[model samples]
Every structure is written in structure tokens, then in C-alpha cells.
Target chain A: MTVEVDVTIKPKRGVADPEGENTKKALHLLGFRNVRSVKSMKTFRIELELDAETTGDAEEEAVTSAVEEMCEKLLSNPVIHDYEILIVGRQIGN
Target chain B: MTVEVDVTIKPKRGVADPEGENTKKALHLLGFRNVRSVKSMKTFRIELELDAETTGDAEEEAVTSAVEEMCEKLLSNPVIHDYEILIVGRQIGN
Candidate 1:
């Protein structure tokens, strides 16, 4: 089975988001007065090949663990960012 | 009412994604052979203030129009990138 995950990395609340701030300012300058705030984030769509025989809770645990490890090691910075992982889709026999 | 929209900007299917490539390579080096592919994207969580009285289809249309206009004007590059918008959550009042 192949598991597809979406990992969204966002700045922790109260952390500085200079890019978002700049974008908000630019939007305001452009006349979007109703715009209140903007928070920027990064997302990764990842496909992982699990054993074709893997299924049920075991498969879910395996995929979640692998994805979380990947996020901790390389995908996101733990210092100021928080990440959320969702198993969006799955393909069988891949 | 205030509408929250999540705009995801991703590289088009055939477009080059150096960041994704590098991440994939890095994961491979880190011994994650199960990683098939990775696609990186940018997301903006935007908060827009609509008229307090606006609701139903009209409110939805208004938010969609405003967000699309923002994307076209500054948020994303349409040439090499494609975007998806999702209205995840909303608040009753500003």
C-alpha cells in the first residue's frame, strides 16, 4: 500500500511571521480593507510505500510514525514551527 | 462574518520542483527508501471580514471572488504553479 500524507508546517502562535506581515501590508496597500490577517505556511504532499500487506491499525500506526519522524528530522523546524500531519489518501497494491 | 480561507499553491504537474527533489534525496540518504515522491507547496490562511449581515451563497461568492483576486494579484504565480482554495473554518463575527 502507498500512503499519501499532507504535512502542514505553521509558525507557532505568537511567533513572528515577517512574510505574512509584509503580505498583509501589501494587501492593505492594494485596497483590501476587509482583510484582517494572513498566516503563511508550508505543506508537503508525500507518498510513502508501505508493505502491500500492511493494513488496519498497524498500517495506520506505521505510516503516522514514519511521517512524524520525517517531519521531525527534516521537514519542519521544531523551534518555532508546529506541524500537523494528515493521511489524506491511500492506494492499494502500489 | 469573517471567512477563513486556505490557499495552497503548488508547482504544476510537469513543472520542476528543486526543493522537492532535494528533500526526496535527503530522505533517501536518511534511509527512508519507502518515500516515493514529495511535492512542496505554499499555503496562506487568510482571514477576511465580510459584511456582518452577509450570509449564504452570496457570502461564499464574495469570499471566493476576493480571495481569487488576491491570488491573481500577488499570492501566486499562475505560469508555473497551480493553486487550490479551501474554506476550512469560519467565525460568526469579527
Candidate 2:
């Protein structure tokens, strides 16, 4: 089975984002005075292949495990950032 | 004028991405051994308000200037990162 996943990681509110702050300041200079706030984030779309009789259970388990491990190990900073995941593909046994 | 812009910044190839590298290793452990490579990147979607007779020229200028400044000053390290921008909105004098 082939699966595509989209993941986004962003700094939690109240955490300082220097890049976001600087962008806001630059916007102000560019005549966008009403700009409220800017936030920085990371997004990724990944394609993976798995082996299973159906796309439902096996693929789900593999994707979930892979993403969880990825997040814990590298995709995000547990202390300051949060992540969201989206799985899109044909469901098995559907 | 109101505009929405999406920006992405990523490390250039040949530049080591420690986070991405760590994630790839983690994925391997999770049974995704066939995974080739992983790259880390940042994305931002910004909404801004500008003043002008039309959403076209005013917005185009404002967004372009703001993004350029943001990229140069904070969003990326010119030496090792690159950025891409997308503008989506109603064009003026369409």
C-alpha cells in the first residue's frame, strides 16, 4: 500500500518566535500596520509504501507508528512545539 | 487591500539537516526502512491588510516587499536556506 501524509509542526502560543516577530515588524514597515501577529511553522508531505493485505489496518498501524516516532525523535520539540497529521489515501476494505 | 501569502523555507541540499536526519533514523526503527531521505522545512500563511484603490497593485507591492524583507532579515539564512512564496487573492483591475 502507498500512503501520503501531511504533517505540520508549529510553536505553541506564548512561545516567542523570533522569525515571526521580525516578519511582523517588516510588514509594518511595508505599510501593513494592522497586522496582528505572525507565527512560523513547518509542513511536510510524505509518501510511503507498506506491505499488507489491506490498506486499512496494516497501513494505519505503520503510518501511525512512523509518524509518532518521527515526531518524538525529530519532527517537533516536545517542550515548545505541537504537531498535526493528516492521512489521505484509499481506505482498505472500504 | 487584503492578501494571503504562503511561504516556505528550507535548507539547501548539501546542508546537513540534523532534525531531518534524526527523523529518518527514527522512521527506520519504526519499520520504514525503505525511506530514502527526509528534509526539514518551515511554512507560514499570513494575512495582511493594505491600503490602495485595488487589491492588485497595492497588495502585490506590499506582499512582495514584506516577504522580501522577512526573508532577508529573519525567515531564512541566506547562506544555507532558500524560500518560496505563493500569493492567493483577488487581483485588482481584473
Best candidate, lDDT: 1
What is the C-alpha lDDT profile of model 1 across B17-94, one tens digit per residue? 999899999999998899999999999999998888888888888988998899899998999988888888789965
lDDT of 1: 0.91
Candidate-wise lDDT, in order: 0.91, 0.71
In the range A13-63, model 2's lDDT, one tens digit per residue, is 778889778878876886657565677788765656666464666667878
Clash pairs for candidate 2? B1-B50
Q: Per candidate, chain B TM-score? A: 0.92, 0.75
The DockQ of each candidate is: 0.91, 0.29
Residues A1-94 of candidate 1: C-alpha lDDT, one tens digit per residue: 8899999999999999998999899999989998899999999999999988789899989988998899889998999999998899999885
Q: Going through the candidates in order, what is the number of backbone clashes in each?
A: 0, 1
lDDT of 2 by residue, B1-94 (tens): 5566767788887887887777667778776675555666788767665554645566677678877777787667999998887785542321
Off by over 4 Å in 1: none
Task: Give all TM-scores, in the order shown.
Answer: 0.94, 0.61
